[model samples]
Target chain A: MSEKNKYQNRRDFVKKVGKWAVALPIAYLGYELIQKTSAQEFVWQIDPYKCTQCGQCETNCVQTVSAVKCMHAYEMCGYCDLCSGYLRQGVKERNTGAELQLCPTSAINRSFIENPYFAYTIDEELCNGCGKCVKGCAAFGNSSLYLQIKHELCVNCNLCSIAQTCPAEAIQRVPNSKAYNLKDGYKPKES
Target chain B: MNKKILYILLFIFIGWNYFIYGQARFPKPEFDSGYNYPEYQITEPISPVWEYIDVAVLLIVLTLTTRFTLKTRSRKSIILISAFSLLYFGFFREGCICSIGSIQNIALTLFNDGYTLPLSVLLFFLIPILFTIGYGRQFCAGACPLGAIQELTGIYPVKLPKTVETILSTVPYIYLVLSILFAATDSHFIICKYDPYVGIFRLNGPSTIMIFGILLLVSGVFINRPYCRFLCPYGVILNWVSRFSGKHLTITPDICTNCRLCETSCPYEAIIPSDLLQEKESMVKSRKKFIIYLILLPIITVGGIFFLQMFSENLAMVNQKVRLAKELRLEKENEIKAISIDAVTFKESGSTLEQLFLEEQQILERFRKGTPWAGGFLGLSLGLALLLTTINRKRDEYKPDQGKCYSCGRCFEYCPIHLEKLELK
Candidate 1:
C-alpha cells in the first residue's frame, strides 16, 4: 500500500512538471508574440501603379463575382467629353452607345458637366472588373479609372487567389488604414 | 504619298509612348460651371474592436466547455454549447484567423521578423493549448467551431478499423511539420490554403474546395469528424499537451460497472476498453523491442534528414518568386521560346536579373536548412508512435483515452450510474 501511494505521488509530480515544462515555452512565445504584435493591420489591396489591367481580377476571385471593382479617381479624371474611357479606341462619335462604350457592362455613367466635360461615375454593381475602360483610359486619358479590392465585397482571404495569379504582382498587403489604393493616391505614396 | 503615311505612323507611335508614360494625358479639366467633384468613397475593413470581442468570447466559451465536460458531465449542455459555437464562431465570424490557421502565423513570426502575429491570433492559438493542459481538449469538445460543425453532422457515426485509424492519425503530425516548415521558409501557409471548413462557413470558395467541403461533410455523417480525427495539424499539438492534463473527462462519474455500455459511445473511438481479456505478450521480448525502437529513433531521424535534403531543390520551387526567376532566366538564356506576362512584368519593374537570382538563391538556402528539421520531427513522431503501440496499460475498466478523447460527454449518457444521479436531480 505504501509503495503504491509513493508511486502515485511520483507520477503526480512528474505529470505536473511535464505540464508546466511544455506550457511555459508556449506561453512565453505567446507573450513575446503579443509584445511584437503590430498596431497596424495589413489587408490585401491592388497597387494601382503596378497593375497592368491583365483582366485576371474578373475571373480569378474565389467569389462568383470578383471583389475587385473599378474605382474612378475624380481628382485625376480629365473629364473630357470624348473620353477614351467612355468611348472605345478610334470611335468616330462620342455618344453613349452600347457598341461604342469601352465598359462591357455599360457600368460607366457619363453625365455632361460643361461644354467639354463629362463626369464618369462607375456603377459598382454592374462592373465586372474586366479593366477594359482602365486600359483605354490609361492609353489616351488620365489613368483615373483603376481596379481596387472593395472592402465591402472582399472576404479578406489570407492569401488572395487574384494576388497569387496576378502577372504583374500588383496586389500588395497595404495597411488597412490606407484602405483603397486610389490612382490619385497610391500606397507608400510614391513621388 | 507612302512617305507621308510613314511619317504620320512614326508620329502616332511616339504619341502612344508619351500617353503610356505620361500617366495623365488629358489633365484634370478646369470647369467654369459650378460642378462639385464627388468625395472618394472607401469602405473600412472589419473593425479591430470586434476582434477583441471575439477573443473574449473565445475565452468564455472555452471556460464553459471545460466546466460542462469535466464537472457537470452533461451531454445535453455540451450539445447546446456546441450549437451556439457552430452559429457564432463558424457562421458569424466566417472562420478567419482560426486556431488551426493561427499555427502558421506563429510559425511565420518565429522565423520572419517582418511578419507580426496579432495579439488576438496569438491568444486564439495559446488559450486553447493552456486550457487543454489543465483540462483535456475541452476546446475540441465544443469550443472549436470546426469540430462543432462536424459533431453536429455526426449523427450516424461509424467506427473505423483500428489499424486504418492508426495509420491515418499520423497525417496531422506530418501536416504540422510541413505547415511549420513552409512558414519558417516564408512560403505560403498551406494550412489556410487547404482548410475545408472555412469555405463552408463563409459560403464561398474555389469550386474545388467547396466540393471538397461538401464531401467532407457528407463523409462526416458516417466517418465522424474526418478532419479532426485525421487532418487538423493543431489537433496534433493539443493531443500532445492533453496527455499531461491536470484533469480529464471520465466516461463514468464513479466506479465503472463494467457493463460495457459506454465502450461504444464515443464517436471519435476515444474510449479505450478493458485490456484484461487480450493475450499477454512475453515480457522479455516486449522489453527488447522497446529498447530496439529507442535505438532506432536517432538512425531514422538522420536518414529522414538526408532523404528530405535530397529533394530540397525541388521543394524550393514552391515559392512563386523562385519559379519566376527560373522562367525569366530561361527566357533570357533562350532556353524557353516564349516570354510570359510575368517575365515582362519582372523586366519592366526595374529590378535587375542579378537581384532576382540572388533572392531566389536566398529562398532556396532557407528551404535547404528548413526541410531537414521537418523530416527529423516526422521521423521522431513515427518512432514514438511505434513505441507507444508496443506498451499496454493494464486496465480492468473502460476509460476515455486522454490524448484522443474530445471531452464531448457522449459516454456520460451511457453510464447508468451517472443517469441515476441525473434522475435523482
Candidate 2:
C-alpha cells in the first residue's frame, strides 16, 4: 500500500509539472501579446483627397443607408451665392424653392450668410454619401464638399465593403485618435 | 487674398496643421459679420471603453465556460451560455470581436510593420488558447459566438463518414496557410471576404455573402458546425492544443460496462469506442507504411511548390492593380476599344502604363516570395496526415477523443453510469 501511494504521488507530481510546463509559457505568451497590443482601436476611414466621387461609397456600405456622409471644409469654402454643390449648373433661378438642387435627397442645406455669400451645410441624416454634391463642387465650384465615413454610422467590418468596390481605393483604416482625413489638414472645431 | 491669387492655390496639405487652407479656388469670403465657423461634430467610434467591457465580458464568459465544462458538466447550462453568446457577441457586438479573423491580423503583423494589433484582439486570440490548453476546447463549447451560432442551429446533425470527415478536416489548415499568405502579401483578406455568418449578424452585406451565410446556416441544420469543423483556421490551432489538454470529458463517469449505449451518441464522431483491435496491422507492415510516407514528405512538399508556383500570376491577379494593369496592357497592345473608360481613367490618373506594369511586377514578386511558404505548409500538413494514418493507439474503454470533442456534453446523458451518478447525487 505504501509503495502504491508513492507511485501515485510521483505520477501526480509529473503531471502537475507537465501542466505548468505548458501553462506557464502560455501565460507568458498572453503577457507578451497584451504588451504588444494598443488600447486605442484602429478603424476604417475614407481619405477625402483620394476619393473619386465614384458613388460606390453610397451603395456599397453594409449599412442600408450607408455610413459615408458629406463633410464640408468651412475654411476651404468660397461660400458663393451660386454654390454649385447646392444648386445645379445654370439654374433658372437661385432660390430656396429652385428645382435645380444637385443632391438627389436635397441633403445640402443652403442659408444666406453675408451679401453674395451662402453657408452650405450638409444634413447627414439624408446625405446618403452619394458624392453628387462632391462631384458638382469638384467640377464647377470650389471642392469644399467631400465624403467621409461617419464613425457613429460605420460598423467597421473586418473588411470594409466600400473599400472592396471603391474605384480609387480611398477607404482605409486609420488610428482612432487621428481618424478623419479632412481636406487641407482641416479639423472642424469641436464644441 | 483676392479671387485671382486664390485661383492658383491648391490644398496639398498632408498632415497636422489645422489652419492650412487651399483647394477651394474661389476667394475666401471676407465676413465683417461676427459669425464664427460653425462647430461641426464628427461622431467618434464606439468607445474603447466598450472594448474593455467586451474583453471583460469575454473573460467572464470563458471563465463560466471553464467552470461548466469541468464542474457542472451540464449541456443545458452550455446551451444557456451559447444563447447569451449568440445574442451578445454575435448580434449586439455585430460579430466583429472575432478570434477567427484575428488570425489574419496576426498574419498581417508578421509581414506588415505598420499594422498595430489592438489590445482586445490580442486578448481575444490568446485567452481562449490558454483555456483550451487546460480545459480541452471549453471555449468552443460555448464561448465563441461563431461556434455558438452554429451549435444552436445544429438541430438534426448526422454523422458524416470517417473518410469524408478526415478529408474535410484538413481544409482549415489549407485555409489558414492561404489566408496567412494573402494577408502577408497584402493581397486581400479572403477569410473576411468568405465569412458566412457576419452577413447574418449585420443583416445586410454584398448579396453573395448574404446568400452564402443563409445557405451555410440552412445546411448547418444537419452538418453540426460545418464551418467550425471544416473552415475555421483558429479551430485548427485549438484542435492541436486540445490534443494535449490536461483534463478532458469522458463518455462515462465510471467504468464502462461494455454495453456500448453511447457508441454513436456523438454526432461529431468524437467518441472513440474501445477497440477489439480487430483491424490492427502487424508491426512490420505499419512500420513499412510509415517509412514509405516519411520518404514521400519532401517529394510532396517540392511538388506542392512546383504546382502552386505555376499559378502565381493567377493568384496575383486578386490584387486590383495587377488586374487593371493586365487589362490596360492588353488594351494598349491591341488597341481594341477606341476609348475604353478604364484606359482613359488609367491615363488621366497621371500613372503611365510603365508604372502600372512595374507595380504589377512588384505584386507578382511578392506572390513569388510568399506562395512557396503557403504551398509548403499545405504539403507538410498533408504529409503528416498521411503519416498519422499509419499509427494506431490502443483504447481500453469508450471515451471522447480529446481534440475532436467539442466538450458540449451532449453525449453525457447517454451514459447509464453518469445517469446513475446524477440520480444518486
Candidate 3:
C-alpha cells in the first residue's frame, strides 16, 4: 500500500477502534446488568441468621482486628432490675462492682428498669466472641445475648481459623441475605 | 545411531518430567476449606514447568534486546537456556496470571472496604513498569507468559491492517476497565479466569474454557499469542503503568539511528515509531481523536454494559447445587428448632444444641455463596476486545520509542540493527 493508504488505513483503524471502545463497555455492562438482575440473589452477601456470635472471630481473623463483632436486638430486652449480661452490682442497689460484671472488656451496659428490674445492652467494639455473658445469661437468665461476625473488621478470609477452631463450631460463613440475626430474641440489623 | 537414540531418550525423559510429573490440580478457593490468610499464600503459584519456560523465554528476549548493546555471543547456549526455562515453566510447573493479582490489589484500594491490598500486587506492577520505562515493553517481548507464548510460536508474524489493529488494541484498555470495575465491585478477577493458555499449563479447570485455550494455541502457531496482543487485561494495565514506570530498557539514543528494523521485529507492535515528519499533524489529530473517542466511548460502553448485564442475569444464575445447599441449611436450622421445641415438651429433645449446629451451618453456607467467583467474565471479554483492536497496524514499517524497552531483548535477537551492531563490534 502507498504511504497515503497506510496513513488513511491507520486513521480509519483508529476510528474503528474508537467505535468499539464506545460499543464494548456498553455491551459488558449490559451483560452484567442482565446477569445481576436475572439472578435470584446477589453473589456476595452476609447471612445474619447462621452466625453464632463467637468471639474467636475477633483475634483469629487475618486483619489486625477481626471484622466480627456483637450486634444488638434492642426490641427483645425485658429490662430487668438485675441485668445478667451487665454489672451484677446494680447502681444505687444497682451500684457497680468489678466482680458483678459479666464481660471481660466491660463492653456490656446496664440501665435502670421498672422498680427492681434493670435493662441491659452490649457495646460492640469492646465485645469479643468469648461468649461469657451469653453463657452467664443463658445459665441464670433469659438467653437474650448473642454473638455476630461484623464484616467491617472481618477480612473475609477464604478459610477462617476461628471457624476451624470454634469449640462450639459456631463460626460459619453466611450468604448476604440470611446473614444477620439467627436468634429468637431481639434481632439486630448486622452488616 | 546410538547417540541419536540417547538424545531422543534424553528429550523424551525431559519432556515427560516437564509435562507430566508434578501436575497440580488446585481446588477452587472456598470459605470452608480453612485456608484464608491472603498474604504469601500461593493463590496461584507459577508451576515448576512454567518457571523453566519463563526463564527460557526471558533469556532469549533479553539476548535479542541486548545483542545491539552488548556483544554478539554464540546463539547455541542462549537457545538452550531459553528452551530449558520454557520446559520448566510452561509444561512442568504451569503458568498463571501472577501479574493480574497485583492489578486486582491496586484496583481494590479504590473501594473502601474490608479487603486490604496484598504486597505481591505492588511487586508485580513495579517490576514491569520499571523495566518498560527504560526498555519499552520488552516484557511483552519475553518475560510475560502471554508474550512468551507469542514469541516462541514460529509463525510468520502478520502485520495487521492498521485499521484492524487500531480497533483490536483498544480491547486491552476496555479489559482493564472491566477488570478494575469487577474487582472494585468485589467480583473475581476476570483476567485470571478466562486465560486461554492457563489450562494448558495447569492442565485443569473447566474444560469448556479450553476451547479458547485451543484458539490461543492455534493462533500462537499462526502468528503469535493473539491473547497477549489483543486481549490481556493485565497487559493493558501493565502498559499504562509501565508508561510512568521508572527508567526501563530503551533503545539507546546512539544506537537506534531511526532504523526501522526493530519495528518489524516487534510482534506486539508496542514499539511506537517516532513520527518526526508528521509529528505535529499526528499529535493534533491524535489529540482530537482522543477527545472524541473518550467522550463518545464511555456513554456507549456503559450503555452496552447495562444492557448485556441485564440480558445475562437469568442465564448466569447460581447452580442448582448451591441452591440446594441453601435449602438444606434452612432445613437443618428448622430441625434444630424442632428439637428445641421437643425438648421443651418432653425434656428429652437435644433441640437447642441441634438448632445451634444447624444455624452455624446456615451461616457457613451464606459466606460461601457471597464469595466473588464470576466477576471476571466481563473483564475477560473486554480484554479480548482490546487485543483484537490494538494489534492491527497499517504502517508498512515498525518504529521504536527512545525509551520503554523492557530489556526482553527480542529485537537484538532478531533485529538487523542488532546484527549490525554485533558486526560493528
Q: Which stretches of candidate 3 lie above 4 Å from their native place?
A: A1-191, B1-85, B105-118, B244-264, B270-398, B401-417
lDDT of 2 by residue, B336-375 (tens): 6535434555666787778889988988998998888788
Model 1 has fnat of 0.64
Which lDDT tens digits does candidate 1 get at residues B295-400?
Answer: 9888888888888888888887777788889898877797784367677777767889899999999999999999888888888888887787677556667889
Model 1, position A15, has a per-residue lDDT of 87
Ten contiguous residues minimizing lDDT sum, candidate 1 chain B: B18-27
lDDT of 2 by residue, A1-191 (tens): 67647766775686677667767876776675555567778889988777778788888888889999999888778898887788888788897764889899988888888887889888888889999999888876778888999988888777787886666768888887787888756664553
Candidate 2 backbone collisions, by pair: B11-B23
Candidate 1 residue pairs that clash = none
Native interface contacts retained, candidate 2: 0.58
Best by lDDT: 1
TM-score of 2: 0.88
- Please tell me which predicted candidate would have the highest DockQ against the true structure: 1
TM-score of chain A for each candidate? 0.83, 0.78, 0.60
* CAPRI tier of model 3: incorrect
What is the C-alpha DockQ of each candidate?
0.51, 0.46, 0.01
Q: What interface RMSD, in Å and to 1 decimal, does model 2 have?
A: 3.4
